[model samples]
Target: MKPSIPYLLAYAFTLASRRADEELREHGLTVRQFGLLMQLRLEPELTMAELARQLGISRQSLHEMVGELEQAGHLRREPGATGRTLRLTLVPGTARLLFDAHGPLMRAEEDFLRGMGKREIETLRVLLQRVLAHATDDEAWLA
Candidate 1:
């Protein structure tokens, strides 16, 4: 019997995450940290709760990670529109680190997807986006 799609996806995610972590480690960043920074870079106005949800981490865990990044000067917290919400931002120092890390990460992805043709990759991306859209009930999952 073939493995379930979810099982295959989980296995693939683990393998890909391990490779990404290895690549990111060269820049002194973890996969989670890099993801957090990337999210902030993509959406500068994301609130703590929103960011935590997007990252699929608990608020407490996000807070801890945020603290670590903040201490390392990679992240900054600023006032939000609401008094109870805090906005997350990547500091200037992280720009260089993230820029430097991009190449290694892309290389890792290319390595992982080795032997796949361009059309296969695009099909996989579209399918994943559809799944995400359905799961999240958000049409803008690709955005």
Candidate 2:
């Protein structure tokens, strides 16, 4: 019997995450750390609460991850410009690490979708975007 769509999605997600994690680990980064960095890069000076909301994680959990990243010199947190919230800023060298990881990450994703044609890939992207948009009212996820 064929697997259900949800099961298939879960399996694919697990494999993709594992592979991406392995690739990122080679450069001293984890998938979660990379995601945090990417999010910060996209929106500089994002506050802890906003970031936690965007990431769908608890503020305390995000705080711990921020601490680890700060200790590793990948990012820093400072007082927000307009509020008491702490804003996250990526360190100067973070771009280099992100650049280094991009190739492998893209390759991993491409390999995962190896057999899909261009149109199929485009359709998949659209569907995923729709799902995400529907699941989260926050427009930041679309960005």
Candidate 3:
């Protein structure tokens, strides 16, 4: 039997994830932690529940990660506008951490796509976006 698209995609994702883990490990970060930070960075005012939903994790799990991040000085929670909600925001110096972490991942991607031209990469991105658009009900996370 031949490899299917889904199989190939999963294999590609595994390769990318492994590379990300190795690179992020150098900075004392796990992929999940990095994802949490990125989500908070993109939407600074997300409440715990909202963040959990966006991250596709449970609230309890998000809370645990939030505690760790807070202790590490990477994130903080403030009272939301409703006063009953707690909003997650990146800490003051978190930009430097994010910037530092971003470089290695991008470099890894470039290395992985070494022979791909700019136009080819753009086309690949567009195709992936189309697939994602078709697969998910909520496009908010795609933004």
The Cα local distance difference test for each model comes to 0.87, 0.82, 0.82
Per-residue error (Å), model 3, residue 75: 0.2
lDDT of 2 by residue, 36-122 (tens): 899899888667887887777898889898999999999987888876667788889899999999988887778778999999988
**Model 3 misplaced stretches (Cα beyond 4 Å):** 1-7, 133-143
lDDT ranking of the models? 1, 2, 3
Q: Which pairs, if any, clash in model 2? A: none
lDDT of 1 by residue, 34-105 (tens): 889987887898888888887778999999999999988898888888877788878787888998999989
The numbered model that scores best in lDDT is 1
Q: What would the TM-score be for candidate 1 when compared with the true structure?
A: 0.87
Question: Taking the candidates one at a time, how many backbone clashes does each contain?
Answer: 0, 0, 0
Q: What is candidate 3's lDDT per residue for 1-143, written digit by digit as tens? A: 89999999989878877888788877777678988998788788777888787676899999999999899899888888989888887878888898899888777678778899999998887777677666655565345
Q: Residue 109: error of model 2 in Å?
A: 0.6
TM-score to native of every candidate shown: 0.87, 0.83, 0.76
Residue 18 in candidate 2 has what lDDT? Answer: 84
Model number with the top TM-score: 1
Root-mean-square deviation of every model: 1.8, 2.5, 2.8
Residue 8 shift from truth in candidate 2, angstroms: 4.7
Instruction: Give candidate 1's error at residue 107 in angstroms.
Output: 1.0
